[model samples]
Target chain A: MTEQETIGFFKCLADKSRLAILKSLMEEDMYVERLAERLGITSATVSFHLKKLEEAGAVTSRKDQYYTMYSINKPLFGVRIIDILGEKTSESEAQKEREKAYREKVIASFFEYGRLKSIPTQRKKERIVLEEIAKAFQAGREYTEREVNIIIADYHDDFCTIRRDMISEGIMTRERSIYRKAERNGGDPEPAGR
Target chain B: MKNRIEEFENYMRSSAEEKKQKIAEMVRDGRADEARAVRAGLNMYEVMTALFGAALKKTGEGEEGFSREFHILKDNVTGNWKRNLEAAEKHGDAEKVMIEESKLETVEEIVRKFDSLF
Candidate 1:
């Protein structure tokens, strides 16, 4: 695991409920209801923890008839702390931190109480603003220009400038006045309603 | 048609206490099954109301009026479920007891889920 993944893994495992779930799975692969009964908690709580454990790679699940059985990922548990700490990072951690700091600085400067005060003039900052605005529109869903404006208008009166900037920066795509949030990597577009 | 719409409006506006009183009267009259059914129906409304409040809060449109009403309905509904569970047990009806227990459990889960959102 990378440093971030390792952090996420440890953060997920730090929870008492999740540790209890892992302990339960250590004994046997159990379904949600059974785990809930064993722990004396509700099934919903068990499912919630299971989702986090699954994301952390601490647990794996498989379908068994009508129930999904969860088991501890023994290999993940076997991984050493020293190995994770000693691993080489593919990217510079400092550079990533600097970029995040810069993004936050830009967002903090331009936004006030969830509304944009003014459009950023600098191309880089403008791109950041446009990307943030694009989050309002659902990915893969097509929207009319009017619909886009109505959504954007909630943020600022100058929706036209922000909307135009989004298209120019390729943060969004427009076809026949219909707009869709653009995929960042020019990858295959997501199927609608996914 | 207008009278029916007005009746529904009045029903919707009626407090949970009024409905509970009616259900209590039905029980006092020894109409246990009918009372149980009416209570179940009222509990369904409570569940729906809580779910609606959760949806509103989730969508960032948690109006204060709705929040107040939601709390009122939740309080009444929780009490109603507990009473149902007790009644089922007293009547020695295993199936009804299970149903009431499940409903209570489910509602508690939903309430916890929504409470965490804030």
Candidate 2:
């Protein structure tokens, strides 16, 4: 984890409500309503906490038909504090700043009011756009083609092209009609073969 | 078995014809978004009606019941998105804040149009 992420992870865990939520998930995966019921909190509150936990990389959720099922990120929990402290920061601040600026420039050029104006023809720029679009997919969740299309269509009109490009570029992978965001370091691993 | 096959074929032919007519009607009514959704088989009400015609009739509210449900769902989603937006702002996560803001704006626009209609 980066310094910012380490801080975010700790800050997210420092809440009683979130800790309770994690405790509940230790038993089994539960949807928002089930979590709410178990904790005696409102569904909205449960959803809010889930969102925070998800951002903190402490919890992961998957689409289960009509509902989203949340579970603890067990691997994340296994990391020792000593390991985190021993890790060297990966990138120089200046390099990170430059990359951030380039990403923003590309996004501003291609996107208009949250919608992509057109797919970029250049391979480099297209890869950046694809990565931005990939953020819509939850890590460790598999989606049907229709579900994938619907999410991609929100960004651009030609979802087919974008979807195909995502697979071709290795940003996502598909097997037996199920789509998953490609695993990266510090990301969720692929589940054992179905 | 042949008779059943013929009956199924006829039913499917008529169903396709009916859907074409419905799409035309949607376009005529200036419901392009809904028409597009119908074309894509993503219109919530149409999908629900197709899946649960008998249950809808049993409810007796039919379309109105679905409309009320849609409104409630939209409002609940709007509430959630607003909270998410607030949280994103608090954390200063620019990308998430932008995504939430855009989503909230789209939902608000849809709600405004829905309110105007009803």
Candidate with the greatest TM-score versus the true structure? 1
lDDT of 2 by residue, A12-52 (tens): 88766688899999999999899989888556456767888
Weakest 10 consecutive residues of candidate 1 chain A by summed lDDT:
A185-194
- Taking all chains together, each candidate's TM-score versus the true structure is 0.45, 0.36
True contacts kept of 1: 0.00
Model 2 Cα shift for residue B117 (angstroms): 31
Superposed model 2: Cα runs more than 4 Å off: A90-194, B1-118
C-alpha lDDT of candidate 1 relative to the true structure: 0.70
User: For residues A1-194, what per-residue lDDT tens digits would candidate 1 score against the true structure?
Assistant: 75666887988887666788899999999998999899885564577678778978999999999999999999998978888889887567857856866886898688755678798878899887777777777878899989999988978899998888888888889998889889762343331111
- List clashing residue pairs in candidate 2: none
